[model samples]
Target chain A: MFRLEVRSSTPTWFNFALPLLAIGATLILCSGLIALAGAGVLEAYGVMFTASLGDSYAITETMVRATPMIFTGLAVAVAFRAKFWNIGAEGQLLAGAVASCFVGAIPMPGPLAMVLMAVAGAAAGAAVALVPATLRVKFKVDDVVSSLLLNSVIYYALMALIEGPWKDSFSGYPISPPIEDSANFPVLLEGTRLHLGVVAALIAAPLIWFLIVRTTLGFRIRVTGENPEAARYGGIHVERVLISTALLSGALAGLAGVSEVGGVHFQVMSDISPGYGYSGIVVAMLARLNPLGVVPAAIFLAAVMTGAEAMSRATGVPAFLSDVIQGTALLAMLVALLFTAYRIRRVGVAR
Target chain B: MSAVFEQIFQVGFLAAIIRIATPLAFATLGEMFSERAGVLNLGIEGIMLLSAMTGFTAASLSGSLWLGVLAAVLTGMLMGALHALFTVVLGLSQHVCGIGVTLFSSGLAYFLYRLIFGQQSVPPNIKGFQTLPIPILSDIPVLGPAVFNQFALVYMAILAIPVAAFVLYRTPWGLSVRMVGENPRAADSAGVSVIATRFQAVILGGALMGLAGAFLSMAQFNAFTFGVVSGRGWVAIALVVFGRWDPWRSAGAALLFAFVDALQLRMQASGLGHIPYEAFLMLPFIFTIVAMAVMSRNAVAPSALLKPFRREER
Candidate 1:
């Protein structure tokens, strides 16, 4: 019988390779599931890959799909670094989308209005986050529960707006009226859905990395996240750090919402996010909370989502296959990551 | 004033509240157990959705509600075990692992549901459990039908509250669980297996969560959709805080939410188009946050909650 013992240190190469191993394991497990779903496993994989990244058109759409994810991923990565646990990014994103809808509907100079949309979206996101952050800091309320609960409230509020005040009477649907043309993100690619939001997402990674790596605020946040008690003793205002982190996290998530509306959807509705906020958590974890790593992680997840649709269309499998794969990847990566810090070695016989 | 009283005092409305609260009661009790044993299973939403799907599908195929219930319970247990694998065995972060479980369960449920039942113009339904009315109690005025008459699972759920309380407070096993949650190192020194106790607590809690899902599919709605569970699981987390981890209080909290929910449904049915229905929908969730904020200060969670136990270190 093999008994497991923990090692103090693991090989550095294995640290980087673990994510690949987790992905490979997830793919293998999902292939079995696909086979059970009655599709040829290799063929399904083929469709998923080709549809997401094979051609320039496909790759462009994948980037479009990745844009919001990049924003939300960075948003979550920021919060998790400080151990803030802002699960309400979903709610924050919705709030931003609502604010953007209002600002985008305004008749103003195109560039000015677009800038205002981003600003308003960020402000609203931060405002929505304020409730949970304040409660967590002042009252010691469980941020996770509070943040999670807010998602439902924010969701219904959006529903009320779309179904009541913002309803597009001309469209015969519950969606909001289309935003003014001035608010639309300038197209980046000739015929594809690619827009300036991709550029925004690209700019976000380096900016966030700079903030985390080069700034005084970043140093304080890192100190607070690692050991609040020690930080307090070190004269760092831990609560202030927490509150600031929460606000910034919400702002990033809010940007994801603005981009979705201005760049991708153009009109606000309830289903504006296909779990981008939740997927952000996955992306953050996959990148190990490194702001710069969120870029590739977001794109990888976006490709999986894009490919799931194509795989479903081609092989008659459900599009939800991506959810399973994503979820499995998250769990597998977590388990695999353990080996990076502590390797399991065989010990004495099992008790 | 008379009309307002009449609107609030209907026996049928009260019965709806009872029916709605039953599943929440089950989930709250389940979560309470896990929290007491020092784990936060955020996978409640995903577990409910997956179990609901499994329960609905099994019932539709074999035409046996009991088997469907069993299947759902089994699924919940598996999820609980999966959570334990991450949080207990591997000593990973509870929050991430719980969320991961939820994602996996929701995804798998959706995929399986789609594969087993192709896209239909209208979703298929199941033959749900019939309501059971107790002998003389169900015949009495307003209180009779509301309290004494319900689906079989509702009775079990209500009964489980007292039983759970008894098991937790009176049994030696319960003592060990509480001890482990409060101080795992101490529990280990006292000869209790922290790993085993945590596993039991999580698995038991998960079974109840599964039962809650089964109740929703096999009794409450008779149909499983993506939105069937919604955020009821999250609401259960709130109830745990509102109840302060006490079984009886938790049941009361669950009923309170259900009353608000049922009232909203009734208000919508009354054709009061003047009022925004979304406001009514938002009421329960808003009430949860307010209640939690007000109650959380006094609420005492298990000291070891969210902290993975390592005997060798401390």
Candidate 2:
């Protein structure tokens, strides 16, 4: 029999190795589904790899897909660090998209339009996040349930907008009117769809990392999450830190929406997010809630997402395999995290 | 009565409200039970979806509704155990594990359904349960037919409230569940097996959630669309909080949500073409959040909810 013994300190190697282990385990586990679907596991994975990372075009596409997730990953990482549990990132993302789209639609100068869009989107996201934070602080309402429930409300609100007021007149489709042509994000590469928001996402990660690791507020956030009582004892206003964390988190998630509107789809729609907000949770987990780690984690998920579609086209496995992988990776990462805290040791008796 | 109000309280509207509430009642009760035992099964959304798929597949393939329901309940119980394996035995974070379970289960549901049915223009459908109207009670025009003339599962859900309340408050097992949820250490000291009781409660909760799934696929929708259980499980989560985890109040909360839903459906069907139906769809969720704020003054979650018990830690 083996027993778990607590480690004095987790080795730094575990931080990187654990995510890889989780990904490896996730693939090996999901391979059974491929086999069950009557497809060759290697062949499906091969297609996914080549299609998502095969060429410059594919890499660029993956990066395009990864941009929003990077933002969301930062959002969740910051919030979780402060123990705020802002599960309404999906709603926040939608609110940001709507706000950004509202700004993007107005006839204005291109660069100025983008700036205002980001500001409105971030403010909208922050406002949505503050609800659960305030509720948790003032009313003692459970943040988890409130945050989760708000996703539905925000979703319906988006649906109402597109299907009613924002209805596309020409197509007769239940989608919002497209944003202004000038407001479209500047394409970074000549041919590829990669946009300026992608570059911004790349830069935003390190900036967030600095805020979380090097700033005074970051120390307060870390302390509050680790031990609220101690943080209060140490003169940190715990509630204030939580509210601030919510603002930062919501702003980052809102930026995910901004990128989607400006970079990918330049209009608010029913499926603007494709569950990217939830995927952020997976990315944050894989990153071990470290803002700096979010970039690679987001890229990995983006690759899976881009690859899964190609895998489905080539291999006949459902495209949902990527969704399963995301879920499995999260669970696997959680299980792997246990090893950081405890080591298995042989015991003489089972007990 | 105004034109909208006139449509909202029609006999058919009453029946629609009951039909809508049935799944929610079951789901709310299921989540309530699990939370009462100190386990927050955030996997309710995915659990309901997976169960709906399995139950629908079983009924369609076997041509037996009861068999399909049984399969769904069993699937739910298995998933519940899986959740317990992580949260209770392994002592993982309940919130994360629940999210993981939901993602995993929902993904599996979609994968399996597509594989088995082979994506076609129209999804496969099964001839679902018929209204098992009571001979005498269903004869009553206004209330009787709406309440009594329902699917067998609907009747089960209606009865579940009192039965659940009885089991939670009357039975010794109920005492154990409450004890474990409130103070695991005290319960352990009192010779109650906290882990086992929690496991049992979660499993039982899963069974009820399975019934909710079964009702959706086998009775309400009669087809297993991907969106069949969309956000209903989340609604159930809110209902549990709003219901204050009491059986009667939870069931009432389900009914209230159903009334709002039924009203929306009626308004949609009433040629109110200009109104966005989604606005009405948003009502119950908004209502739940506000209700939680109002109820938080008095309502308290399980004391030990989200806390893992390691007997040796203390």
Candidate 3:
């Protein structure tokens, strides 16, 4: 039998190398599926990698896709850093979208209206997040279950809004009416759908890093996540820090919702988010829960999704193949990371 | 008072509640077993999805409901083994790996379903499990049919409560599971194999989750949709917490939630467009969160719920 022995310390270079290795392994694994699906492996890979980054327009589209992921990924990373599993980012993003939609539908000056939409979106997301956070802190409820359950509830609620009160008048479909021109995000590039939301994500990355690394709140949050009892003993208000982190996390996720509405969709729809909130969890994990690392991680995932779309159109392969890659990549990464901390050795007796 | 009682207890009201609660009961019991053994398998959701599709596909092809059910259970066990490999052997984080399992399984199921079924205008259906009424017992007034006449899976779901309770408390394996969950180091010192026990518990629990999913597609609906198992798996997770990780209490909570869920549906039907159906849909989840809030205050999770145990760590 082989037994795994824990390493005293993993080398620094190895820590960075594992992600690249995992990506390679994921590609090889996915290639097998592609072959089974009767798609040309090289052609599919070519479309996935180059199509998304092949041209200026494609890059902007990729950024548009990455925008929400950046916020949601940062949201997950922030909460995870403090050991809070904010799995309800999906719900929070919906709430943000709901608020942004309601605010944007009102006729007003475009600039002021857009500002209000973002604020409302963030506030609404934070408020929804606090529900589970408060329950966990005050009533000892498991945040994981509550937050996850809330996602379903929020999705249904969004559906109710679109299907009933806010149903699109012209199409008679389950979609909210289009936002006022004033509320629409300004296109960042002349010919691309890239919007102000991308800028927000770019700004948020460093701001989140500073919050986690430099602020007193960051110290308390890190301590609480590492050891709540020790944080309490060391004069940190662990509950308060956790609650605040939850709020910040929700707010970031909410910003993702606002970005989607103001930047891309321009209206709340039934299928507003294609599991972006859940995908954020993967992004955070891939980035190893580092706030700054989440930026590149979100971009990478966004590229995969964008490429999957191009691949599907190009090869007739189902777009969900991207989900397969994302999910499997996480498992592969986990095993690769495991080897970094431990090594397999022959045990009992050399047979 | 008679009229009020009659209105609240319509002809098929009790039956509807039981039918709705069956899947949840199975899932809740399954989750409880895993949690009791110190592994919280969030893969319950994805397992349900995988089994739903597999059971539906197998039943439709073979025209045998039993075979479909078996296929679902096997698929669930396979996913469970994967989960066990991560949490029990690799000692990875429970929630992360569980979520990963869910994503992988659900994605795989969806991909396969789409690949095989493609985009059909009308989704295919199969001959589902027929109701098996207990003789004499099923004929006893309103109580008789509601309680005794149900799918075989429903009867098994109910039986699972006591059987699970017995195995967890009465059997030697039960003691080992409890010991491992509460304190793995101590359990290891006492000659219990923590990894083996956890693996068995997770796989067993996963099979039940498969049953729950099969119950939806192969027994209740007779057809499968992407939304067939929607939110029920998460409800099971909440029920386990609300039930305080006890099989009996978990069953009771599942029944109660189902009752409320049935009532909400009835109310929606009666209200006839006055109340948003979504509000009614939200009832079970909202109630679950509230129940967890109240129940969690007094109920503690298993001591080693998410902790990975290593014999040499101490």
Candidate 4:
């Protein structure tokens, strides 16, 4: 008889295989959804893969989309590693966008203006994050609820600003005035949408990895996360580490917001992000909170998202089908991770 | 100032506040029960959204608002049960699992709603819940109408506070539930089934959340829209934290949130309103976060809250 046995620690192979298994499972489940939608499953898959990465422009689009995911994913991964749940990435992103818009709207010189806008955006995002970080450290407020609620509040605040004070005077649209051309992120490729933001995010990934692996602060954060009591005994100042990580995470998430506005949209709008902050959570989880792994994980999500539109156009499948696939991937990954952590074993004969 | 007082004293404004607070109150209490049982039901927003769609569709089809409410409640329960299964049985992280449930349900609900209703140029409208005024209380000039004149669900929501408080702090089952939340190992050794208690609490909370969603679809508005819930679930979660796990306090926080919501709506409707509509829209969320920050310091959560329980080796 086939039997299952418990393992104290998951094997290395299982660790590497989990994400692949999750992707496979998600594809199988999504294929059923495609069939239900009256589309041929193979054709749907074909459209998705081809449209996401088949050509140069598609690849560029994927990178553009993946840029923000990389920053936000790293933001989340860093905080999660520190055992600090900063669910307010969305709010932070919005704050960053608002700040960037403010900086960009000012008539400053080109390079200095762009750098200042990025700095201002990062500052604003970090400032918004300070409330929850302080509350979690000082008052023990659950960061999850505060961060989530703050997101809506920030979104509404952005809407208020754009619709009220910052409304485009000439166009009468509910969007901010476009930033000066000099303040905008320079496009990296002549014919592609990819911008300097992609470079910023790519650089941030390895920098974060280096910080976690080499720095004293990173050591404190890891120690605090592993054992708060022991870390406290060791004089690590757990709360300080948490607060710093939360702020850093917020800053990174803010950079994502900056990239969206300065890099892509060139102006701040109310719906600046299509839940990139939330999507970052999935990317972080899929990467197992590894800073280095975030790059590949983000690219995968970006591909799936980019492909969904193509699949929809070609096969009459709803682009929203991608959301189902994404959600299923998250769920499958969680289950796979849990099984890897601990397996149930029969103590004796089967009942 | 007197004129402002007079306006605040008006029955219509009071009624509006109570009406607005009704769904929030029910959901807050439901969240209270779930959190108190050591499970944070972050899926509350998604549950409300799904229920709103289901309840609205059912009522529209059956031509009975009550039946629609039932359908909404049942759907909420199922979602709640799913959450409980994942968090309580499968031992998944409450935060992630809750998020998954919300995303899954929200997307699924939207998909299904569009599939069934088709994207009509105008949204479907249905008959809404009618008010049932308390005979004696309705006679009072302003207070009576504001407090007593409401839909049946509103009355049920108001009644839930004391009932919830009594059940949570008074009864044997309540003690077991609290035990499970406080110290699951001890509770398990003392013959309390931790899994069963948590499951029950979550289901009960889900049923209430369903009723809350039904109220949004069946009473407050005569139709269901994609944004019906509108971050109310997050508001409820914040209220639970602000209230510090007490049923009455949670209800009070919900009432406070309702007042802000009503005030914002009123300001938007008033021609002399100074605040931007979006600012008003964001006020409740801002207030909730502030309140959470203030109350978080001394807040005493359940000892076992958010930690999945496993029986210790004998």
Go through the candidates in order and give each one's C-alpha lDDT: 0.90, 0.92, 0.89, 0.86
The deviation in Å at residue A322 for candidate 2 is 0.8
Better of 1 and 3 by TM-score: 1
List candidate 2 segments past 4 Å from native: A348-351, B271-273
Of 1 and 2, which scores higher on lDDT? 2
**Residues B175-282, model 3: lDDT tens digits:** 999989999998998999999999999999999999998999999899889889998998999999888899989999999999999988876776644678999999
**In candidate 4, which residue pairs clash?**
none
lDDT of 4 by residue, B41-128 (tens): 9989989989988999999999998899999999999999989998998789899888878877786677667656766899988989
In candidate 2, list every pair of residues with a backbone clash.
none
Candidate 4 residue-wise lDDT, A76-135, digit = tens: 888888888887888899899889988998898988988998899889888988888887
Candidate maximizing DockQ = 1
Candidates sorted on lDDT, descending: 2, 1, 3, 4
Ranking by DockQ: 1, 2, 3, 4
Interface RMSD of each: 0.7, 1.0, 1.0, 1.4
Query: Candidate 3: which stretches are off by over 4 Å?
Result: A1-15, A343-351, B1-8
Chain A in model 3: its TM-score? 0.94
Q: Give the clash total for candidate 2.
A: 0
Worst 10 residues of 2 chain A by lDDT: A342-351
Off by over 4 Å in 1: A1-15, A345-351, B271-273
User: Each model's TM-score, in the order given?
Assistant: 0.97, 0.97, 0.96, 0.94
Worst 10 residues of 4 chain A by lDDT: A1-10
